[model samples]
Target: MKRFFAKKVITALLFTLILFTFSFLNWKVAYPDLKVSALSYWTDNEQNKWEQLSTLIANVSNTMSDKVFEKYTYIETYGYIQELLGKNEINNFEVIKATDGTLHYTYFTSGANDVSKLVERMKRLNQAASEVGSKVIYVMTPDKYITGVTKFERGMPYNYANETADNFLEELADEEIDTIDFRDLMKEDDQYKPESFYKTDHHWKIETAFWAFTKFVDVLEEKYGFEFPNEELYANLDNYNQITYKDSYIGSMGRKEGKLYSKVEDFTFIYPKFDTNFYFYAQSGSQEIKTEGRFEKSVTFTSLLSGDGDVYDATNDKYFTYMDGNPAFAEVNNFNEPNGAKVLFIKDSLMVPVASFFSLGCSKVYMIDPRYYYGNIEKVISDYKFDYIFVSYTPQNLTEEFFPFYESNLPGRWWMHDCPFINWNGVL
Candidate 1:
């Protein structure tokens, strides 16, 4: 019995030595510059020696751990077990499988509370826009899960998103705010097939956006009496250049779960067939760059096809191919509709594909993503003299910590320029 115990201790010591040696060699090869230096602990004469040594040890330990886990065999086994048990949530994303073997990501809600602050902010914005004769229209876009919930198994526990949106919309209506709820439109539209949203992505497909845009146009025409063109363009499938890539795309959610649990999905990119010339202006920091070109001739050209090289490449986000991802601020001047009205379209990533389509009805469309755009939103509305102020965002965005109107400054702080609205002193 004593011999057996002695043998086990020796074996454990041997294993520990081997692991330490392997980790050291790997770290030395990977990070040759991470050497012990006499001055490293005394850089600028204020650095603490103990703190530097502790940081160095922690970094090396983390690197070794990462290397070991990169090829760990148990990770795949653990993920498989989790999936089998229907416990496939990763971080804040819940991976729910549809009956058709499609994967959809449902983000956990951040709780619904008093959006009174947000409502009050919107009311102030409406009053200011009303003074300038600009109609403020709030369009609440639906999440993929909300519209595609029928595909999911009954009694899933993530209804907080729907509840939150409903509460906010109800509050907005009670406050006499003009809101166009696309959730109702999506529910009524027969075209909202299971394929309306991406199987692996949280965002709805381009076709879905087109359908929602049509409904929004209808609301504009009915309430504000605005005549919008290209009404039939979206209705006809022949008007779009559809490029399909089968079993080639994996969205943000898929990337999070890895290929083990999340299956690859097909991507169908739909580009407008009509000829539209677009002059784009993007503001970044203190510099503004302007580019004048056609839709097919610019960065949007990539939207016509998947990423360059093999279709199976998983590096590029295929959805970002449309409208060049999310820019801080962009102004699209559609020469095709020079006589159309000028509008300010504020939205999130859900509105990326649909943003340029607005130019078909409006001459100049200022697309501002409040999450990234730190400029004065109210000033932009006043300066542009926008005939319409359209706020389009998904329901999940309502629960976002960075939801636009919730900010005390209406559009949040301006990191790039000084926000004049902050110092308006009750001046409309």
Candidate 2:
């Protein structure tokens, strides 16, 4: 029996070596994608222990950016070892100690390159909108640091380096571009903290997102003469001292960390009244998990919002399906009447929740985020002849705007043909 067991062990070792050789060759052949497509799948039951072999391969993979690799090294090499053994879900976000024991996100380096680029690019886009007839509006979203407190073992409280943000907003208005500052609508009550916007994520809390909804409604009414009924949104400022979740939160950017226990502030289930009942036609080609409840609920009942909540819901399920460039269609059964004007929205993921309320004002709203839409934008717009063209973006990727509306198929506009407008030689 001992001899037979030894032989079996030797056979198993040989087979493992052969499999590794095959996987390595397969990955090497697919290097341009960094074997990113191949390595994503992890056999659910195989995560018994960390694999040193996988780590060595990850070190050798040529295409990974250092930033991306550092953030996901565990998944790229070790696999999800503890989870397979049925250990509790991991703590997704950990504040690493700096030299002085100050905790911070692994990638929380300070810089303003992103916001500066975004506003400048948006100015050009806003100018393009003016050339064509529709006006542009800038909506700045509040980061998690601004709206609420994130429970942390941290160093110092950090605010967005948007010192130049207000100047940029003023610059847009100085040029006569229409704009909305949403920070005005956020709960100013001192108690709101990081956990309110997203229980397990970096997003603004649900009710706060809804407050942004109120701002959009009021502003859209002022701009287009559309009517939106008054909404009394719920804003919970008291009882924040109570302990909840206890580190089980896994935010959007933080989810990769895999930690399961985190403490956070939570919102109540109070629903606001809406005048019209709406229908949600999901963006096709999606395998998204449905969330439940009024908003992104606790980990104990994550399905609470199912993410299909009313657009007014922070995790509003309605328009986001299309924000990523899918066919997320929304409609009001009897929208009072004359609901005929068409419009196009060029935006990013931050605009997803924003669109939830904006879509309410227009009879026909066609929103397309260029990152997800590979088609020509002008062609899409000319085909539809939208009455208004609105461009919105968040501070994170604001500077990276491509001429999403530029298309060879469309007619040359007077502005495009005439450089004279940009540089007037003493006269128009």
lDDT of 2 by residue, 1-428 (tens): 99999999999999999889856755554464544323431321133214423533554463343223234445322225643453223343333322221223423436444344445555565555566665456666654444233333444333343444566676677666677665545554332444345544545544455456556666677776745433222222231122233222334433333332222223433232333332222221112222222222211133432433321222332212222223322221124223634566666555555554444444555556555332345444444455566665544434444333443323433222221111212111
All models: lDDT? 0.65, 0.42
User: What 10-residue stretch in candidate 2 is worst by lDDT?
Assistant: 419-428
In angstroms, the error of model 1 at 312 is 10
Q: What TM-score does candidate 1 reach?
A: 0.72
Choose the strongest candidate by lDDT: 1
Per-prediction TM-score, please?
0.72, 0.54
lDDT measured at residue 280 in model 2 versus the true structure, 0 to 100: 28
Q: Write the per-residue lDDT of candidate 1 for residues 1-428, one digit (tens) a residue.
A: 99999999999999999999877766665463344222332441142345346545665665455444233244445556667777635544466666665666564445655566767777777877887889888888776664344565564336466667788888889888898877787778765456787777778887677666677777778888987877776345588788788776776665555556666777777667877677776653233546667665543636336456533233267776656667767777777778888888778888777766656667777777776555567677666678988877777676444445424544534333443223322211
lDDT over C-alpha atoms for residue 81 of model 1: 68
Off by over 4 Å in 1: 1-87, 92-94, 98-111, 147-156, 230-235, 284-291, 299-306, 309-315, 404-416, 419-428
Model 2 TM-score, all chains together: 0.54
